[model samples]
Target: MFSGLITYLDSIRARDPAPRSRWEVLFYPGVWAVGLHRVAHWLFQARLYFLARFVNHFSRFLTAIDIHPGATIGRNFFIDHGFTVIGETAEIGDNVTIYQCVTLGGTNPTNGVGGKRHPTLEDNVIIGSGAQIIGPITIGQRGRVGANAVVTDDVPEGATMVGLKARSTLVPAEEWIKDFIPYGTPCDEPCEELMETGAGRLAELESQLAEMKAELAAIKAERAQPIKRNGTDD
Candidate 1:
């Protein structure tokens, strides 16, 4: 247990920039929640359901993070601020980073029973703040969920997901390994490169605008012409 705690501290330190010392990690709500979750999960595995819930409730009260005891979480799971919820039957893989207000939840709570209800996050997944991953969706390895995204479907491996409706674009995992991206925004392409890529789209919009202007001018010219009145000048 001590060794595991040490590893947890190391992982949190590696990811979070605010913590200055290992001792400070102990005060972090995420660390507290995850540490207690280990104990709760152990009791749950032993079939001590009541005891597990008791511990889980205590952890929630203490840390303000709610993680169901039945949820299976792998190693190196990091959570930022509080208010994160991981429902029962939710499975989280290793090296996952979840920010505040993230929810791994079910679509229909009453319908799912004795089965997987919540989402499954694969290894190296990054969930940005206020992201909601609902249903029995699988977030593939190295997947990124952008801030405030509402995802109800499976995300492919190495995908960068964004928006409320959740659109995704592939991002090479190798590029992600080079640097940490904040808010899960696509940063693989530099600003200049992105501008260069959008040149065609910009031109298309300009052409459409020009066509609209020409049509407007033609309408104005036709309106300006004298109106014919009964085959004679008015």
Candidate 2:
């Protein structure tokens, strides 16, 4: 666990998350999560709901991640980076990898009815950052969701979903697949001025097109006008 911290600190150039150096009590995030979640799960099982939530909140605050008490996360569930949030009623299968900004959320808010609203993740499911999975859906085993994808329905096992309202893409066995699709992790600067210039030009052309259309309409009206009163052609 201490080594996990070392690796994590090395991974990011930001400030350290912990000051503890004791090897005995120290644990890696994977180990810590597995261990702590077991305890939290027990607390939840024992109906210590409030206390479990409190501990879950603390874990998330300290780790920059959050998992709700009502969530049933299986063994070896892993999360990387910050801004990951799991809903209370979410059920995660074993070996799920959740990246940053991923949300396993509830679809329609509960209006006091006691039914399942959160999505269920099957084993080995991997979710990329900024992905939203809503509704009482089942993401089948080994299913992968791409970055920024918004899912509201069921996904079959081993299927990959992408785009805004994510649709599944069937993958062949030969393809090299990754748990999380790489997106939005860029630190390099982009050509903003060039993009802005192109946008500006497009806007200018649209404005010119509108003006030309107006002028053409005025000319047509002028030509369409019959000769005034007595001046009208017989």
> Which candidate achieves the best lDDT against the true structure?
1
lDDT of 1 by residue, 87-152 (tens): 989999998899999999987757555587899999988999999999999999888898899999
Q: Candidate 2 regions off by >4 Å?
A: 1-34, 109-111, 176-234
- Count backbone clashes in candidate 1: 0
C-alpha RMSD (angstroms) for model 2: 9.3
Q: What does candidate 2's lDDT look like per residue over 1-234, in tens digits?
A: 767655443432222234344342234453354445666777998999888878887777666667777788875565656677777779998767776788888867558774788899998777878999998899998788888899998998777777779876545454325443333122222211123344555687889999999999999999997767776774
Deviation in angstroms for 66 in model 1? 0.4
For all candidates, what are the clash counts?
Answer: 0, 2
Candidate 2, residue 28: the lDDT equals 41
Q: Give the lDDT of residue 214 in candidate 1.
A: 100
